[model samples]
Target chain A: MPEHAILREVGLRDGIQMAARFLPTERKREWALRLKEAGLREIELTSFVPAKVVPQFADADALAAALPELSGVTASALVPNLKGAERALAAGFTHVNYVLSISEAHSRSNVRRSTDEAIAEFERIVALKRTQDGRGLVLGVGLATSFGCTLQGHVDPDRVFEVAAKVAEGGADELIVADTVGYGNPAQVKTLLPTILAIAGERRVVCHFHDTRGLGLANVAAALDAGVRAFDSSLAGLGGCPFAPGATGNINTEDAAFMLDSMGFATGIDIPALLALRRDVEGWLGDERYSGAIARAGLPKTYATAPRTAAAPALAS
Target chain B: MPEHAILREVGLRDGIQMAARFLPTERKREWALRLKEAGLREIELTSFVPAKVVPQFADADALAAALPELSGVTASALVPNLKGAERALAAGFTHVNYVLSISEAHSRSNVRRSTDEAIAEFERIVALKRTQDGRGLVLGVGLATSFGCTLQGHVDPDRVFEVAAKVAEGGADELIVADTVGYGNPAQVKTLLPTILAIAGERRVVCHFHDTRGLGLANVAAALDAGVRAFDSSLAGLGGCPFAPGATGNINTEDAAFMLDSMGFATGIDIPALLALRRDVEGWLGDERYSGAIARAGLPKTYATAPRTAAAPALAS
Candidate 1:
């Protein structure tokens, strides 16, 4: 991992999943092309949840097929169960993201599965990764509602650490701590991040924050202070948790990139281009409420222009 | 002076000044009453600009008259020039905030005076404070566009320091470094804050950030780490500088207060109450854009309640 930060754009999967209107597969592909051209290295292409649950991601396979022929960008998809994992694997995606709700109530209500059942499925997915070529496939486990749960208030940090240890033991290549409902504050982020990093180690830790309660960036700062590097963000601050009512949106990718770039940290993404892509997204969504500061304010007057990095050839799986 | 932070609300003045519609005086008074009830102790009520320039504050006199009953709340007003200062003084406000643009270009464009002339007027304002009833009236001399000016990029830190030193030498009680056009980042904030504080000393250093480029809260955290305790925020993240096109809103007060309260730094403001008041403002503004996360997300499930502090009795003049 270079010192540069990685921002995985979750708008395609997490953003449109909650929209009232479903975008056509072509539009999703267009967004993917725009994001790739903007130098976003990783894009969560879509989720494999059943069409009945979220119609917005109903064209997941179509989108996965239409992914632009961009080299160096890793296209990933979200899987909630063994079936979703199978769909994602069949779609030729190199990376699969699995989410397990740490809050037992949330787990049951969201995926209709007990914690043990979810773990069993996760173990199966890890085993499946071994049978495949294994070189190209990356398996990431996200511990959702790690900070606090809406249905069950005050998620114990001890439980989160335990789950992280289990995920690490189960052979997840990456582990992300998610404040699914945006109940995380900087202090809580500081308290929980170190323990999770200790269990999962540094290379595996990724922090995902929602701006539901306005602590998204603050939590990011706290996690950075705690030594975690990779982050998950959505373009235009799209996406709200279906299970978490009033949970507004994910941390905006362009805004987060701008913040990181301005802090003297290299993000390897073009801030101006990322903002331009936001305009494309807004045009696609039409009447949706898109949130982010960089999209509205443009780049600051004193923005230090980032030097473009040579594009690495697209990885051949 | 306490380990806690103080977020002085500038919404009524800074927020509404750039608004397209003028709020009724009665509605403005109601906002003040509700903000006071929400435990906001310091509020910049209105700017004493000419009615022709900013008709939104035409009722500054009536607003000031209504503020005396708020007891422990310190009602302050912004004075653009000597005439505005006279109006504020005559309105019975003991605390008046004066602003001087540091960038000579910004100073000329904003107040139609050169930087040298603005400093001279600041000296006169300090002298005018002495001629008053000797009630120890507080005067805050704000260095607008201290970080970077829109018209002139790359504001020199030395000039910022010079202005701070001059303001303090002119006998102003407080000094604030303002990012008037939302052009500041954490690195710049961390670097320049100490230099300004070294010149202005500890308690006098205040930071005002605009979230125009999405680094507002991050900049605030950087300032806090640099030992700054006083901040300026607007309720609902209102206000934008019209002269600087593409300028976004200020840092939202309720959101900032929530972050501070959650960090175990006491801000002495009720987070939920402030959010509730945001609803009223949204209704009053109707079609206007209001930015804040706390109001939209509702309160977090595990929100730690603020420790209560009984309001001190109104101090005698």
Candidate 2:
């Protein structure tokens, strides 16, 4: 178990945003509270994007308002521009995530802005964070399509590093390298993570991977070996990138936690508890596909020997 | 791209053994020829066990004799004992695979033999092969449940190494480490592969993984990083161990080829051609469940830039 690895639950924001039917605000709040109680320290609660463009997240502010004020638990929102950032701030979120696509074509199609203009907006969001009443709203920037793009293939590593460095210099508290199209392999991750880490430094680098090509966990192992400690995952492997065709889910949170916890990494998260949460999410979605293994096969018997409390009786039963 | 990877297609032997209905002998022969044409060097063509136990492979002798004699391809069969090995040799198979489960519980349930008895039988099979014809006959001893066993829960690494060493000393040409219950993680792989490789220094070590827990490719990457060059996979992700409950599907052959090819490794096999052959297998097993991503999503666009011919036409189209 490494001392620094962190797993951020993105099912609320990234997962629900891609669902066909909108989850009620009460259900969303219930999930957030249960997830935090399951030992997740940080969660991407919702996106602050416009209501008209993504109606699924129309109740982001209401959900944000209902979040339990747990000490040491950080609730964050995704913001595409300065307007989204302002809304997130107004909703009282202490953490804001701004995503900018590194591929010009994908950026233009996804956010309707050129790469440079998106970076400019990121700078504006960073500047706005400084003037707010110092509740210390941390700003994080994600470089989407940092691996390869659907529209533009073979995104340059230099471009990814450059964007990462620029965002860090512009006052982003952290920079996440994302495989938006799920086009990355372990070799690609090995090639790209060092450069991004070198530019963003050790503490600022977070790795986000997709399971589109079935290389999600392999990519995570590669990044972990390369010294990445923070990861973004969707519960039950929910969510698909609307812009990236066939990009159906992020890495499964329980699967990732199981991998880390079994390897002696302290995730501080309960594996079976997270798996139980998956069952609840599945009931809500009915037949919609959700990806994960811990939900299918209960945690291995050896899990009890690890440094964690006994799994809940209800979950084990 | 390493120079020594051996991708053994197990679709015919392990994949179809559990199928409810038997595929026509001609269809199996067609699959053999197509796989050979696609440049798969070694294939587990069928099992030579009693027809009463597995009726699906009742035509093993006929199917083996019908295979096209290609220059680089080596046809192999799974032999449970000396009788099965004799049958395989009589049918002109140049290679024979002997199964020896490392876990005592699994070995008993799977073959009704103790681990020591299985190893003794392996030695007898090697002796029998040597007495008849030695040149073209390659003997590979597969150590199933090397990582962990479903019934036993934890397989001791020392026991795995000792059995591998004893098998190698007894006359096996190659050794394969199998995660019989899909209980292996990258960390466990990292810890075990080196020890196995060190003990069986002269013999080739092939890794056999199942996607039961969705860590198949991750295990491959870990083994590859640890210098393992050979792997075992089934087309369309077919096959499940009857003795190892909850074990479903070997690592998908097409998906493994795609991952290796995408990472700059030359499998020598054609990716798209394999996908087409996968469809043929799927058609044969009318109601069977088949899995793999490359067949569903096609190859990533970067595949076109490789020094390979165009892929075969899509299976569904």
* DockQ top scorer: 1
- Candidate lDDT scores, in order, read 0.82, 0.82
The residue-by-residue lDDT of candidate 1 on A179-236, one tens digit each, is: 9989887778888889888888644688989988877887887787788777899998
When candidate 2 is compared with the true two-chain complex, its DockQ is 0.46
- lDDT of each residue in B1-317, candidate 1, tens digit only: 23678888999988889788889989999998988888888889999999999999899998887867777888899999888888999898888999999899899999999999999998888778888856667899899998898888788989998888988877888887899998888778889998888888644777999888777887888888888988999999988897666666789998898777666676778776887788889889776668887877777767756443532221111
Model 2 RMSD vs true structure: 4.1
> For model 2, what share of native contacts is present?
0.45
Worst 10 residues of 1 chain B by lDDT: B308-317
> For model 2, how does the per-residue alpha-carbon lDDT over B107-217 read when each residue is reduced to its tens digit?
998999999999989989988978866455788889999988877878888899999999988888888899877888888999999998997777888899987777889
Residue ranges of candidate 1 with Cα displaced over 4 Å: A1-3, A66-68, A133-136, A304-317, B1-3, B283-286, B304-317
* TM-score of predicted chain B, candidate 1: 0.94
